[model samples]
Target chain A: MSHMFRLLETGFNPAVFNMGLDEALLRSVAQGESHPTLRFYGWKPPAVSIGYFQGLHEEIDTDACAAQGVDIVRRITGGGAVFHHYEVTYSIVVPLAHPLARENILDSYRLFLGGIIKGLATLGIPSEFSPINDISTGGKKISGNAQTRKLGCILQHGTILLDVEVDQMFSLLKVPLEKARGKLIADIKSRVTSVKHCLPSAGSEPFESLFSTTVGALEKGFAKSLDLDLQRSEPTLKELEIAAELAAGKFASAAWTALR
Target chain B: MKLELIGKPEGCKLLRLTIEIDATAGLSAMALIQSISIRGDFFAIPEEEFDALERALAGVALGKLGLEFSKLARERGLQCAGISGEGLDEIVHRHLATLNERN
Candidate 1:
């Protein structure tokens, strides 16, 4: 049997709203108010999002981020910090009772990551799932994901890098002094890659073109990989209202961002 | 003296351990520890429980830090991703041993 999912493409949104929407969707699905959903969106003004367990002061340079006009928010999921620029971020929410939802964390990642692998293949990039939560091509990471189960649903969100900006990223993120050498940065450059790098013809294209192409490919990827019947739609009034409240009270607040 | 150590165990996220120890005392002794803070991009769920583990670790003897951490994880039913109590133990033990060799 094919699963029906709500497909939401919300374009570029601020960090607070983006995180808020994800949490709202997770809660709605858990309460049976919404269908299983797959949302594709981008960050406006760029942003840095840290994991739920991470300490903001230790992971991010606040003054540098503010000076650069970058936003910072903490994710509800658990994983490493990510610089959200030149990327198409995706979030999927499914009930815990879904057959695709596995009990073991690593196994769940492997199952969910297959859609991404298929999506990358559509763009002529052959990728494989690197255990825990990463998708890589030629052994370099192109997508990083994080997951958490909350409100009776599994919420997994990740980014598919459309471009690479290593120097800018390192500037915003803090590295331990010992690992701040040139070699570490060089190693990261070699280890992290982008879709533009994989497809040279599209590398220099406009942002809209790149975004549409990746979004289209990913939609088909999920449909084919998971046998999903995707219904294009917008968020409900209730969801939007909840998202607004969450953005103001939880995601945008200093207390939640600084909570380690 | 204050010491900070970072380690990235295989198949795990980065881990940082900060400790303050008495300079005049032997490195492995129980009384040398003043404070400890463990921070990283690791996941230990029922997330709030991690604070308990971190608090339990404070003032612990250096030699038994790993054992204590492992024991606490078991007691709290910590299911981890990107980290393990034993892996943490190894990093702490190795870091302390390195300091001992240096001093």
Candidate 2:
């Protein structure tokens, strides 16, 4: 049986607005006003998103982030800090009782990430869904994901790395120990891989085309692998209004970002 | 006493705990937890339930922190990933034992 899904390609948005829109879509799907959704988006001005349970000051160098014109926000989902740049971010919202849902966290990730794995394959990159919220190619991580279940729906969001700038990432994020920063940076460089690095002709292709190219590949990958009838759509006016409020009121608020 | 401890159980992510201990009968008395903030890259579904777990840990004796935390987490049915009650129990108890050695 083919499931119906709303596909929204909301190109670029501020960090708070991006997070708010994801939550807003989750709420709408849970309330039965909209279909389960698969949305692809990008962050404007770049950004750093920390996990819900993480301490803001512990993970981020706010002064550096602001100085570099990067936005910062706390995700409702729990995971490590993520530098949102040179990546194609995707969010999938599905009801708890949906066929794709799993009771076990690891099993849920295995099932939900099948599309990503298949999508990577479509791009000529064979990837596996690494346990505990990651997608890996070979042994290096290519993507990181975070998920939260609320209001009878599961909202899983993640980033697919198109390119990586490990040094810039380290500059924006604080290490566990200042002295170990060099070692940590070296370790991340070895352990992380990206689409541009993996794809044969990706380097020659214009950087601007990577986003659309990857998004298109992923859209087809999800539809074929997940057995979905996806209809192109826009964010409903109600969703946009609610997202704007959430952006200003929750995601952008200091109390919420510094919640831990 | 303000105590900060870091633990990383075999199968869980790094857990950083900033705890305030209130000793009821002076330094030698039973140490009770004034408050605890659990921070890490762990996943707990319906995060509010996890927040409630933080609140529910109040006044729990330092010795029983693990038991109480495990019990409350199980009761709340917070689906967790990268962290576990047993892992937390082992981490807290092990850290305390290390603290005892310092004195």
Candidate 3:
């Protein structure tokens, strides 16, 4: 029998609430308050999320972010900083004891990310899971994921680019060398691609249509790949309350964001 | 002397090591590890464990840093991608050898 998974389609939210919901879902699943969950979400006002151990000042351009009205939040998982815009973000929370969970980190990533690869395949974008948590197509990274195991559950989240704005991303992120900024942006543009770019069939479609189509394909992809019997649902009141509290107290706080 | 070494091992993230080594005694010794920062686009689960792993390597001899790092990772059951203790050790040793040649 396939494992039953709760599916959440949280369209778009501010950065803090989005992160807060992921954390809350992680806790809820850890405590057996809910079953395993797979959520698809987007960022509103866009955001820059740095890894758990990253030095905020080292990775982000604070003044640029503030001027552009981009929110910055620290993630509980470890990876490079991400500019979360023009993307489809997904988070999965599964108990460690679940059959889907693997004790080995790489093994877990391979298994979980298979769903993503399958999803992309459905979109006609043939991608592969690169070791350690990246999904790539045509030798360019299409998705990057981060995972964390805590409170007896595994929480993994990542983004699939729908469209990329290199200049805006570089504006919010620090360049290792000021002189190399242009080269860096050019390099990233070459390496990073979006679903829209990959799918010639979706030519001239509105962004919203393309976004929904991608999300739909990913949903079916996860269902088929993971053998997940997904049931559509909304966040429970308890989860919303917890998420609200976490958003206000943790994710949105300067102390937490600057904790590097 | 302080040695700042960086290595981007194949299939691993970049590992940067800043070590204080003592060579006044005629042989290089690990004086102290000022800091060890791993960067790049890699993932390590239970992210906080990286700090513990770094702390565990603080005072080991230069010759044994790699082995020590590998052993500590095993003991802690660390899960890392795009970086390995053995790979990092190779980088550190390579950098140290270069420094020794110059001296």
Candidate 3: tens digits of C-alpha lDDT, residues B1-103: 6766665665556555566656566545454454455444456666678778877776677777768777887788777766676777777778768878999
Best by DockQ: 2
Off by over 4 Å in 2: A177-186, B24-30
Residue-by-residue lDDT tens digits, candidate 1, A159-258: 9999989999989998764443422555655778999989989867997899889999999888889889999999898998999999999999999999
- Among the numbered candidates, top lDDT falls to 2
CAPRI verdict (incorrect, acceptable, medium, high) for model 1: acceptable
Complex DockQ, candidate 1: 0.47
TM-score of chain B of 1: 0.79
Compose the digit string of candidate 2's lDDT tens values, residues A41-99.
99898999999999999889999999999999999999899999999999999999989
Report, for every candidate in turn, its global Cα lDDT versus the true structure: 0.85, 0.88, 0.83
> DockQ order of candidates, best first?
2, 1, 3
- What DockQ does each listed candidate score? 0.47, 0.57, 0.37
Whose TM-score is greatest here? 2
Which candidate, 1 or 2, has the higher TM-score? 2
Regions of candidate 1 where Cα sits further than 4 Å from its true position: A177-186, B1-3, B19-36, B56-60
